[model samples]
Target: MPAVIVNIQGPYTERDRKLYAFLVHAVWDELGVKRIHELPVARINKVFEEHHSDTSQGWIWESAKRLAMTSVEWAQVEGEDRLHGIAHLFSYAATHEAARADGVLKFEFPAGLIPVLKEPRRFARLRIHFLIALSGKYAVTLYEILESVANLRNPVLEIELTKLRQWLKVPEDKLDRYVDLKRFVLEPGIRQINMNPEGAGFSAQMEALKSGKAVERIRFVIQKLDTRVALEKQIKPRLEPPVPPPVEPMSAFGILLSTRTYEKAKQAAPDFDIYGLEAEWRDWIKGKPRPNDPDAAFVGFCRKRQRRMEVG
Candidate 1:
């Protein structure tokens, strides 16, 4: 079965709230390790696989696993007013299994297909290349190659200007800062220029050269190149998925209960705590009198009569 990826949002029901809570607890147990199946997320994983299939052992499976492992990252998109949203990464095998067991699948991903995942070890230096190819950007070819070397933490990998032109099929003069900006998509954290150490303080030089002062064209070009290169390094590493925020208490119930018309309760029980109110509501749920209230006798009688349909 081929894998599929999808996303979901939430103002979840009682059952969903409980299930999401349980899944979160499970995910915390499985951090920083492979074999994502062993995590608490497995329950939701099972739900996903039921809609997908696990029968394949080819590149599709690898892709499916990558999609699944990163599936939990949907939490990054959750908003303050939104209770929850889900993203699904499942295979045909898993989805079929789920349909056989549960009868129907409710959620569908916005993207209909999952990206093919590359073998981690086999992609030691070619990871960025694979991303560029997957994204179908021919212009990104040499840029990705350089980025791959940069990501290896190899500080000495240098491409000659002529070699870079031959490799990228672009003019030497046209080779610009976009190449460096591409690095942020892959590495996201590195900052500094490797090719020109003396060019570190070039931004001010560019500003000073911008007055159309025919004083020095060659110096201006160098300064412009340095400024653009700095901008690229400054922007690349931010391409990774954002860090998920710390989990906070849900405010939906608070907002909903606050807006409900409990005018009498507000006046009669001015300091009525919600938990206390719920406890009271549960106890009085079975047509029982609310304890210690003079009005409890009448409320209980009315409730009992309603149950018997005697008044109607």
Candidate 2:
């Protein structure tokens, strides 16, 4: 729960990531005392619900298999110096058939790998609730890396750009340019992390280390938020009256009209009244099948209508 093993990979899918994180939490309390942990399939599913509000048997089984097969490699400064192996996620998995039937899941971790999670020299402590709602892998990765160092006196984590990319699991070809990485990856990841309702609890800014105009190291200046201020903001909003939610449309045409598709239609045919066009479209689609992509279909109809009016 507190430490993250660095230079780890795989658990690529969202479900897989959540499953691995849940396993870490499950074993956290019993880290040193026990090598094996058993969790009821119901409880594991509950963990998913606590975060995501839903789960299925197929997803659980797939995630379990993925975790069991995943490998983690790391370098040791002393003694062996380097280590690598498959199925390093756990030493044993005995939940094959039972897991499918909603039974218990039993996991046994490798002895040496236990301490990597159990007793890390440096690690990030984060609220599991905050992590649950995060949709992007990059957001989760950056949050963990930054949160790990948030408690330090300096609260600044500086790493080489290459190493940062590796930690982020960025492919070599993607975001190859520094500007592109900052624009697409770094900014969006930080934005998503900070946008959480409970507050991301930290702010990050990237500083470039330049050697004769060539950027090298990236310094992440992380600052922890003051809890008092965050709490005040949360409380102040409750005093106001709750606003009513937007009305949802029932029919396909209504759905399209209520969406940004309506705005696009207006733009494509500025002189054409959207209300009248909606009526025309509703009539045009009468006795016909509904479109799978109503928004696109609406736009196409509007363009055709605009062209016909021009010809007339």
Candidate 3:
């Protein structure tokens, strides 16, 4: 639930938000300090499984590439000094063959942005699990801002409409009118956050400040949920290994291809006829020495076959 200061753009897809959240959590220990971190693909895949339920190795790899390419703008103003720049989430490298083989992702934080990411007295301790369930970017943004001030002695936070829109990264043309903004963005986001059991353990409502019949600023009233009720609802079941469902007996060919290898092959050669490719792979490997790791060998065969097909 630690917070990291980030300047992100609007219209973030669900996967992108999840990836961003993961990155924030991954670098929590090193936040505020210039340091590189090693994040294993397996750990990231575990989070993907919890949030997305699909953790194919190829999909994970592709997602990591996408996350690495995402750019964000950072700006800080300290009295007479002003700093601003754009950078990707992190710089990536495999470092070693063993690291690549094991699917380790190395991330180097930008030195200039370390100060913002470091420990700060005022920051949002966002509950990642709740954020995962929220589909709208507005909901996530509002939840973070409200959660940051939820524990303050006075639970009322006020901000101008323009600043709120900026912080939420709302597009300029979208929700231009106060009524439209309240009806579309504010109402739905507040409703979603309040409905989520793990969302900051608070319910939020907004009061509009009117200037001569025109809404000027908005105030958020955040009320914390009862401690006992919050604790009871937050209890989560311990994670355990998934039990394989019973299946019919496999054919000879099916038995030869382990589940892991078959999945890898499917991902690697989605366009190729899997049965035909399997037959070809089987025939090609017939006279060869048995591979130490059959799954890896099968994946390699699928990749090579895919390349050949692309060339042909």
Instruction: Give the top-scoring candidate (TM-score).
Output: 2
lDDT scores of the candidates, listed in order: 0.29, 0.62, 0.61
lDDT of 1 at 302: 37
Candidate 1 ranges with C-alpha deviation above 4 Å: 1-138, 151-153, 171-312
> Which residue pairs show collisions in model 2?
124-148
**lDDT score, residue 136, model 1?**
21
Q: Which prediction has more favorable lDDT, 1 or 3?
A: 3
Per-candidate total of colliding backbone pairs: 26, 1, 1
Model 2 agreement with the true structure over 57-147: per-residue lDDT tens digits: 6566676667777676654454544444323776776775634646777777777776665444222244444565676777777776777
**Worst 10 contiguous positions by lDDT, candidate 1:** 250-259
Sorted by lDDT (best first), the order is: 2, 3, 1
Per-residue lDDT of 105-145 in model 3, one digit per residue for the tens? Answer: 66676666555544342222455555656767677667777
TM-score of each: 0.17, 0.62, 0.58
Residue range 134-176, candidate 1, lDDT tens digits: 2222223322333333323222334333333343334335535
